[model samples]
Target chain A: MKPRVALKYLGLTPFAIYVVIFLAIPTILAVGTGLFTADGSFTTENLLGLFAPTVLGTFLSSFWVSAVTAIVGAIIGALVCYAMLGTRTEGALRSIVDSASSVLAQFGGVMLAFAFIAAIGNQGLITVWLQDAFGVNIFENGVWLYQVPGLLPVYLYFQVPLMVITFMPALQGLKPQWAEANATLGGTQLSYWVRIAIPVLAPSFLGSLLLLFANAFSSYATAAALISQGAQIVPLQIRSALVSETVLGRENMAGALALGMVVVMVVVMWGYSALQTRTSRWQR
Target chain B: MTKQTVAQRIGAEPGRITRWVILVVVGLVFAIPIVSMIEFSLSSNNGHGYTLDHWTGLLSPESARTYRTLFQGIGNSFLLAAVTVAIVLVVLLPTMILVHIQFPRLRRVLEFICIIPITVPAIVLVVGLAPVYGIVVRVFGGSIWTLAFAYGITVLPYAYRAIQANLDAVPVITLSEAARSLGASWPVILWRVLLPNLRRGVLAAAFISVAVVLGEFTIASLLNRVNLQTALLQAGQSDPWVAVIFALLALAFAFVLLLIIGRLGSVSRNRSAQ
Candidate 1:
């Protein structure tokens, strides 16, 4: 390599420094701090405290809600992509819809929270219309909607689009001729879909769903905006541990919790990766 | 044969009905959020009266200060995103080339690092970085800079994966060999031959970064920075209309991003074909 080449390599310094200080160092600190006690002794208090009823409830609720969101989003997204396949309509409408889905996929967190609230809050249009026109009360006497249920619509804001994006390539990979041939063989619609369509779309379906699960599980803003106080998921709890300095004196506790969450995510994502590898065969 | 023939007869007829049903149902389901938002924004006194006070109020001089604040937040967000894209691209491009050149085994490791952030959740990241951020702020004497730091880490997965895919697509060794044979320096091969070829990935990554920055509410709000998402949240607390308008604007931002991505993808495809 010449001197100029070496000089260009030096350009890599800014990025290298930024990543170290911001990402690596801080993450290490969070784990280190959360795992150690005030007396400089290693303790599992924070990680154990993570199992407290309040924290556990939030985790369980988030798990179920996120699971539903991922599955539903993937299914719907796959169906949407399937419907769009081979359609002759090509213009602004198609592009607009595609764009809309893409935007919604990335538009989660706090913005999604606000969007859902505005759309479904107490005095929200949907809320009011449902009450006056149909005499239905979504949250009449229960804290259900605002808790885990309310998080669903917000989750969908991103989940559906994520599914659409992830599943599109998979859909395209499935040869239409296979379906045509099956149809010509006098196969029933149900059998054709169950035997052929499902098998072909299975890998994409599984991969997309897993990806969606990871997306929703790691979500913090949507839950925070929806049920700020009561339901404390891992992320919110982690944020709280950092902020409430008076109570959370042991930084190690925070670190332990952070490390635990990272571990769980790694496991989940490992499964996702395995699914992706298995589904690679479906990709044309 | 009869069973197969019977199944085929049904399959031969397109499930147009099911297709239409799925289209209408899913389309309506997806449209609900946007429709509800528009209704809320257009409603007066929180939908009690059908008036455009919320929309009209936005234009009034009284709302000017708030608009200024909102615009400032947006500006800060865009600046953060711009810086983030530049930082991420610089880091991702060279690292990608080096990994392909020297450490093929490290590819998965690097990818794991990138994807780890995705699974960590924004809240965890903010929590983990808060102490680090505080120290940096105290030492460096700046708070807004924290947003860039946080955004950079959170979006690393997106940037890395995109660039990695693109790197895999192009003939990396061929390009490097071509450069080497021509007396081109490694830097020239990396920058001129490699970086230019990685344009599509860069664009996609940039868009993801933009989306991440613009829509980043947790980290910004947690740190009490007045980014667009935080401002929107605060506005909603005071008056629901503020949240509604913010949501509309957010949708607009998302729409623009989508259009840009679509255009970029098409252009890249066209170029690749050529």
Candidate 2:
């Protein structure tokens, strides 16, 4: 590199400093603060709190929601992509879905929760309509829609769109030549998919699955908006540990919860990246 | 004998009906909430009959007092959005261009740093930020706008991808080198030449950053600050109608913003191809 080029690297310093101070330090403290006492001495007491039944239950609930949403979102979104495969890649329909997916993926948080509330909350539009037309009640079993189970449809709302956005490129990368070659060999449609397509797509599909899991696992706003009471999941647990609904500041318990969440995200992202590399080889 | 017939169907393309059916069903899952929002917002306060007071209430003078918290939160979110976008355009954008132009080897490191924020969830990040913010309050005086510092970091992955994609597509180094050979100084080359070409990516990144900032709640709420989402969450608890109304507007704003980003991408693609 020339001196001029070396000088150019100085342009990165501000961004580097900004990221280190805001992102890196907070992340380090998130995990490190969990392993020590408030007096700054080392202790595993906070980590041990993670194994307590209530904390364990919160982790299980978060995992369950993330896993379920990831699986269902992957399947449905892949189907959407599959349906879209025949459409012209640059056609209006493709652009519409692409744009819609990006928007809907961003359209989580309070807006999404409010949308769902208006749709199916107690005395919601669908709630009243369903009762009037079909005598059916979704909340007949005691408002599961307001609890962890309720997070299912809401999570799927964003997850499926995100899946479509992430998975569609891989779907598009499936060349026509492979199908043509499979056809020339007299492979049936099912056989072609099972043999040629499924194997090739497996890495991308699984990669996308992990991405969805991490997304859902890390999601906060929708869960925060929907469930106003109780720490039913890890993020909310972190919230409750950090602050009650009105009050601010709490003990080191939130740090342990965050450390666990970080561990999960890191593992998932690692798998996603490794699988992504496999998918990329095919992209070329 | 039947080999050719089997081969003919190997593409596994679903029937047109299947495609339309899948699209419609999923589209309805998305549309229903939006429609319900509109309907619910137009409904009487009792949730019985239809009315437009909630929508029009936004501009009512009386609402300034009644909905002060929600409006304040909205204003703070807008301010945060602008500041966060500034942080991206000012800090991240130049670093990316520098990496692309001068130190190609650092591209990977730049990407790694930007993407790390995605892996660390905001909720988790807040736990770490709680103590850090105590120090932040000492320096920044506990203003809601300080939340944008965290918002800037949280949006790194999204911002990086948008700008990096454009940086990759455009020949940043070639363009800059050409400008340099023509006696243009580095800053002049950057400001005059590189910025114009990178407009689409910069716009998309800015818009996406705004979207993310406006939706930010966990950090602001936990940090004892109020932004749009926190205020909406509070309003939803007391006055559900007003909350839903504001939520609908926020959704519309984000929807339009993202659609423009998508258009910006393809429009540039077409122009370049032509």
Candidate 3:
């Protein structure tokens, strides 16, 4: 019986070994890369690079971008969910928004950045059209579409939809019985939401907010495609460190930068999971 | 009871006008860029006036040279998507099924392992992968297809969730027990009994793998690979319109795929509950 049970776990070996080699080891090496020199001698010098102004600036911008998008997206997406709450389960609008949000949420990257470029880049469609019709230079402020602020609109494209996708379940999980109960106590429509739904949804909302923050923070291809000139975010910082020739013997900067990113992601995801547990409590 | 009692089932249908107002406003925000992409792609040049030349240029002789790399990237991405999907179906699928029926205790650990990819961003993963690829190159050749190994990890959190949701919905244990009572072999049971039942989740996992692989850029680009995104970026440098056109096309393809996925999600949940 013991041998048979051991044999049952044979199926896990392929996946276990795969992640260990590709994921687990690489994660360890990624964090550890900053602590060693080129000749493989252990040192802590390269990690100080994480504190350098440029990296800090990138992290600052990353936080600002993520926080803004997460907040804005959470608001818009929560409103979208509130809008969707009225529609029947099998309604066309509900499913369209459901599927559309799913698609938009996953579909951001180079393609999305290009779509925005075609819309608002220096010679973009809207840029050209607006110039021709109204004689207004939308890019008079230095082609913001290609800069850090530019990521907001593009990031929101995915962020809002992702908010809708993740937060909708929490919205839908609102039991009908609660509303009826609130009404039996002579509570108004506004009162029910103020008292019951808001409190119950606070954790889920915060949880989704954290998720969106991590998402926007870690997103690379969209930012990489847009901000072609400099490292304006954490992911882009890692990119430049990976490719630039002028790291000045600091090969571990990219490692340190990646380590920084991993730390943020770990903290944010940990909070998200904790909130998720709290959220799921009411869900069941 | 005020007028609220009549609509209490869904809790006050929120004023239909209000609902439409919010949805339409948000919908248009999402739609504007897509419309611009189409309009931009249709334009002949950066100047005024429009022509089909840009669209027709795909068949032109010069475009063949211009887009040679783009074609190679698309091909490589498709191959990567196929291999990645194969990995999910073959390795992840069986392990999940086995864990569900045989070793239920490992489910949480397996879930954690699968989800670990989400916490480590692709950029950070690439930082770690640079060295692993060294070993990967030594063991497997430096072919672009091997990049699927990393993609397999990236797509894990997605594929696992899709399959596991279905696994939870299905009565895998009951079916396997009955099959065993009928004297069926484990291989036969998995092949004949389980795969058919998992069609929705399995197909969803495969579609998700394809969608993710097509959009992947960070790993392939950092690792010096040629895939759809890297190819698109390069092509955009020379001919931006064609690049936008292809981006629009990829976007449309993904939209349709996810629409189906969305349907699959509800269909499975409803069927299993009943």
lDDT of each: 0.73, 0.87, 0.88
Clashes of 2: 0
* Deviation in Å, model 2, residue A75 alpha carbon: 0.6
- Number of the predicted model whose TM-score against the real structure is largest: 3
Give per-residue CA lDDT, model 3, range B191-213, as digits (tens): 99988999999999999889999
Model 3 CA deviation exceeding 4 Å by range: A1-3, A245-249, B1-13
What is the per-residue lDDT of model 2 for residues A117-156, given as tens digits with 9 covering 90 to 100? 8899897889989999999999888988889999999999
Clashes of each: 18, 0, 0
lDDT of 1 by residue, A101-144 (tens): 77878777666666676667776667777898999987787746
Ranking by TM-score: 3, 2, 1
**Chain B TM-score against the true chain B, each candidate:** 0.86, 0.94, 0.94
Q: Quote the B-chain TM-score, candidate 1.
A: 0.86
Model 2 agreement with the true structure over B1-274: per-residue lDDT tens digits: 3233222356556566778999999998789989998998899976577888888887888989988999999999999999999999999988888778667788898889999988998998988898788898899897878888999998999999999878887888889889989999878998999999999999999998998898888898878798999999999888888998888888888889999999988987787778
Candidate 3 structure quality by residue, lDDT tens digits, A1-284: 69877787676799889989899999988888888876789887778878888778889999999999999999999999998875678888888888888889987778989889888888777898899999999888788888899999999999999999899889888887788778788888888888889999999999999999999999999998887867888898788888872553587778888888999999999999999999998887
| CAPRI rating of model 3 | medium
Give the residue spans of candidate 1 off by over 4 A: A1-16, A88-97, A180-187, A245-253, B1-14, B46-53, B59-62, B66-69, B101-105, B172-196, B270-274
Q: What is the TM-score of chain A in candidate 1?
A: 0.86
Locate the minimum summed-lDDT window of 10 residues in model 1 chain B: B1-10
